[model samples]
Target: MSNLVLFTELRQRLDDHLDLVSRVAAEGDAESALSMIRREVPGLVAAVHALVDEHLPDDNGSCRKCRSGPFWRRIPAPCRMLIQVHLAVGAAKATTRDRTRWSPSRHRLQESSVD
Candidate 1:
C-alpha cells in the first residue's frame, strides 16, 4: 500500500479510538478513557512521525522558511539549514525511542510524579 493510504488508515484508527474514548468518558469512565489514550498515544505519535518522514524529503539544503535578520540584513541559509537538520534528526530519534519503549504493560509501572 502507498504511504498516503497507510497514513490515512492510521489516522482513521486513531480518530475511531478517540471517539470511543469520548463515549466512555461521557458515560463517566474518564479514568478508563484516559488509560486507553495513554496506551494508544505512542502508536499515534509513531504513525504521525512516519507519515511526515515519508512525505517530506531530507535536507534539500535550502531553508524554505529562511528569513532575513533585522540587524544583520541577511538570510542565514547555512544556520537555518543546520537547525532544521538537527531538529529533523532529533525528532526522528525521539519518535523511534518512544515507539520502542511503548507497551501495554509499561503503563502499569507509571507513577503520578507531579502530585
Candidate 2:
C-alpha cells in the first residue's frame, strides 16, 4: 500500500481507539474504567511527550523538525506545532470538564443532528 494509505489507516485506528476509550470512560463499570485508564493513560502521555520532544527547540532555539523540504528554514522554538498542541490540550481539558457545554451560533458550530 502507499504511504498515504498507510498513514490514513493509522489515523483511523488511532481515532477508533480513542473513541473506544471515550466510550469506556463514559459507560464502562468503575472497575473496567480504572483498568483501562491504568493500561492506556501512560502510553498516551508518552506518545504526546514524544511528539512534543520532536518539536522542542535546539541549541539556537529553533524548531529543527519543522525546517525541511522545499521550505528549508529554521522556525523559532514554540513553533506552530507546539502552539497547536498547547491550544488543543487546553481545549480538550475544558471539553472533558464539561462535555455537554457547547455553543452553536456563538461557537460557529453547525447544529447537531441529535439536537
Each model's C-alpha lDDT? 0.53, 0.74
Could you give candidate 1's per-residue lDDT for residues 7-58 as a string of tens digits? 9999999788877764664464768868876876688679656654543322
List candidate 2 stretches off by more than 4 Å. Answer: 69-73, 95-115
Predicted structure 2, TM vs. truth: 0.73
Top TM-score prediction, candidate number? 2
Give the total clashing residue pairs for model 2.
0
Clashing residue pairs found in predicted model 1: none
* Per-residue C-alpha lDDT of model 2 across residues 1-115, encoded as one tens digit per residue: 9999999999999999998996897689999999999999999899989999899787877787886644446688889878777766654455333443334234422333442
**TM-scores of all predicted structures:** 0.32, 0.73
